[model samples]
Target: MVTLASMEPLLPDSSRELEDLAIELTSVASRFAARLHPIMRASVGDLVRSMNCYYSNLIEGHNTLPIDIDRAMAGDFAREPEKRNLQLEARAHIEVQQLIDRGEMPYPVLSLDGICWLHGEFCRRLPDDLLLVRNPDTGEEIIMVPGQLRTRHVKVGEHIAPEPEMIEPLLARFAEAYSFKMLSKLQKIVGVGASHHRLAWIHPFFDGNGRVSRLFSHALLRDLGIGSGLWSVSRGLARNVSDYKRLLSQADQPRRGDLDGRGNLTEAGLAEFTAFFLSCCLDQVTFMEELLKPEELLNRVEVWCNEEVQMQRLPKGSWPLLREAILTGEFARSQAQALTGYQERQARTVLSSLLDCGVLTSPSSKGKVRLGFPVDIIERWLPRLYPAVR
Candidate 1:
């Protein structure tokens, strides 16, 4: 019974409040992206990707620790089968996101092809054990095909998704309605949230719809030039998970009489979800901005480095070189002596200590050194990013 018309009101009403949020998010995200050094941005982006994967997976009831994720990135898998599968799942999410971050996708993320790509790319990387989905009512074991639309009906909670036959046309309408090239910048921002709910409602795939929807939203923001991968709404959503799920379900409600606008679904509900989505994004950007504030960040690093030096874990004068890297993003190895006010040999010794501890990194033996975010230092360097590795 579902038709293309059933997915009407692709966007919520452009109330002043919604417009204000869109404008504010655009401004804040731009300022945050502009503030970081290119090298710093890259380092931060890497860490945020892991954080995004962690939080995104957490939302799906998978609890892969931050350290395990780091280990997975290093190609070190857990010994237990279940744990290893989750690690691979986490790795797959990060790899697919990296492609989106690097703009390697051939299709626009809002397009049907793009959504399938996200699903296929992520799922294809996953282990065979994770591909099977069990039907709750029938106890039928369904093997999910990567990138392929579901051939059977499915239900998520109380909501029955659109028929499998309706998915293609629904997604086609979706891509055209929220096309990035068509919407105004502010509208695109709003559409990121609106499209997010619609995609989840459609549930195009047999599994991995939640992950695909999130990845889609992330890519949409990046495409809009607002998300630099330095901040993610995943963390915010995970933190407020109850409200996040509640809002998603709320947005699925049908129209509430004539006041809810002309749509099969509720416009007021859609608007509410969009506003919550944008607010989460703005809050995350603001949180990261404060965490990366030069003075505060450097102070925290210096305090940690000084403690390590006193404890004889790091060589004396280690703070200065770290300070230099943070300030300049990266520095020549030869400048280490002058930066630390130490003799050449002593400076080299200090640099080696940092590299050995994984607090600094270089492309080659003699390449410029940039700040590194090893798991051990992440808690000190970027506290509250995730639970400390234990």
Candidate 2:
């Protein structure tokens, strides 16, 4: 197993740019988590409802952007879902679940090979022969099989891939780093992200490097105590697909005079990439802040009811119940009846009217209702999602 002690930070400009970016991103996350009203303030039902709300919006986003490969990686591939990617993620999710469940400390499962396949585990078993190299049309080099249709209309360019003889020696030098055990939260996560990026820059395998990079990112979050379950960084990265590519290229691009993209890559690109990546994470923090912002929902309700209160009679004595139902996550007509201190028929009318007004929307299903698309105000805002305390 490779160990981190034997490895050095891939992008360490004496300028300390990467560290600064990491600190900024992490600080925003901590501040956001700290500022939010205690989740306990909301009932367990509300928390569950909140997730559903966010998920529904994320799904909608995915559907609208069908070809966005990165979004698909985030577990939002319901639109043109791939069975193989689903299976790999399922396997990766489950395996990590086992590690977390075991309460394993100084997690030993962070092996290099496992980390790679864990990201693209679905194709890990594919024969090496299938790992043919092809330049996509985008002028950027990408690896895929001969028969597979190029989904992205990629502009293939001259192969700028690295040789294994070169990579193997590099790996041998850091074999200990590949399987190194990470003990601390910050070190482990920072390490994981850096490691994944480095591996991709190397273009180690003929196939699945992108998938592997994503999987490693997801696993690192788990190891770092971000979320209780697998994270959806793939989705986050997918959302900024262009930035991700540009940053990766920038990080790997030859610093100067090395047109072949050989020699030590520049620190500026990685620093920018890491900073942007962290910014992406803070984006998620902002999203959580919105969900946890009690006033967000209340503000919507106030806006909806203000006019009704001004122009019309307050729905025949059902104001109180309607207010409580929307403020809380109550969707059932019967629940509204009790909350409103009104007749059952009156309560139903009030609740249905609120839904119609879009103050309290729910999915098509019954017995389950909550604030619906008010969720999307933060959907595209989703960053890496829970790097801690999911």
Candidate 3:
């Protein structure tokens, strides 16, 4: 039987070299997370969640746009059935992620139950057309059983997963080594990078393993507070898909002789992959940190508001209210006229235009108005965010 020994050196050696890299990852994530206000962090997190789903699906070769995803959230799926299913899939990914963000998964993220739950929740809502996979050899149709490990063998590219019977034992060992209490905070962060490849290698389900494994990593990072709802590793991975896949494939190789540690797999390969993963995450956080600089964001918004007013797309003097909302997160309903410096009637017009454009959102018309990040304006407001809806 295949055992955890084969996957030993789950992390790299604790040499000064690996330690320095790990510290760099931890430091970068901490600094990026520290720069945002609590409310802004939540807002950015919400935006990142949408981007996360988009990139995660993109990895699966589904190219749904971020604007379409926003429309799907509003229950406006595409008219075409195929396009509509993709929208549904995107919505499902976002919904399951929201559950993870809320800490609703049943067991520790690396556990058997947690993995199964993530798979089940995601697959349960998938369109029927997507629930079936065709066997390349026999032309046999296989229906994926939600939340269940495969009852038959399968191959992914050049890597054949462990036999069906070994899935539970391997996953149990996975949970044992990776559960939160078993490692220090820093080790957990490293695990977030390392476990991603290992779980993909495990490939417990017949389908959706890639998405589930990514979601699992997302949940793990969020649980550790390293992710802090501010950034996503998925965006980083999707942007570097070629290297990401190459590293994953290289990590799957058999042990490269005696120098590769005492494991049945290569320690150097795992270390390299982990380094790449952490680096991708750091890059994403850095990009967001720069993209979200307060002055730059406010200038962009001011420019956009000015352009809109010139085009009559928005009422004049709306920039002040938008600037106030961006700075304070929200402004009182009664203060709207003062902020916009418009009369009572014009103030209502400006506020209504902002609300209509999704530049602002309120739970009710009478509730406090808060800054919104509508995807339509994201290119102008948060440029280079998720490929500009192409």
lDDT of each: 0.91, 0.46, 0.84
Best by TM-score: 1
108-166: candidate 3 lDDT, tens digit per residue: 78789999999999999888888898878678899988898988888889988888898
Q: What is the lDDT of residue 377 in candidate 3?
A: 86
Q: Give the TM-scores of the predictions, in the order they appear.
A: 0.98, 0.53, 0.96
lDDT of 3 at 47: 91
Off by over 4 Å in 3: 180-182
- C-alpha RMSD by candidate, in order: 1.1, 9.5, 1.6
Best by lDDT: 1
Model 1, position 17, has a per-residue lDDT of: 85
Question: Model 2, 1-390: lDDT tens per residue?
Answer: 223222234533323544554555566556654553332223322332233222322322322222222233334444333534443334333343344334542333355445433434334433343344455443455555422322332221322554444555444443355445543344444455556667665555554556545545545554455541212344456567678777767765545553322335555555567666655655654555565455665564555556566777346444554456545555565687777677778777777766664445565646544543233222222222322222
Residue pairs of candidate 3 with colliding backbone atoms = none
lDDT of 1 by residue, 1-390 (tens): 899988888999998988999999999999998899989999899999999999999999998998899999999998999999999999999999999999999897877899999999999999988999999899999888899998999899978899999999999999989984666888988999999899999999999999999999999899889964999899989998998899999999999999999999999999999999999999999999999999999999999998998999999989988998899999999999998899999999999999888899999999999999998788887888785554
In terms of lDDT, the poorest run of 10 residues in model 2 is 381-390
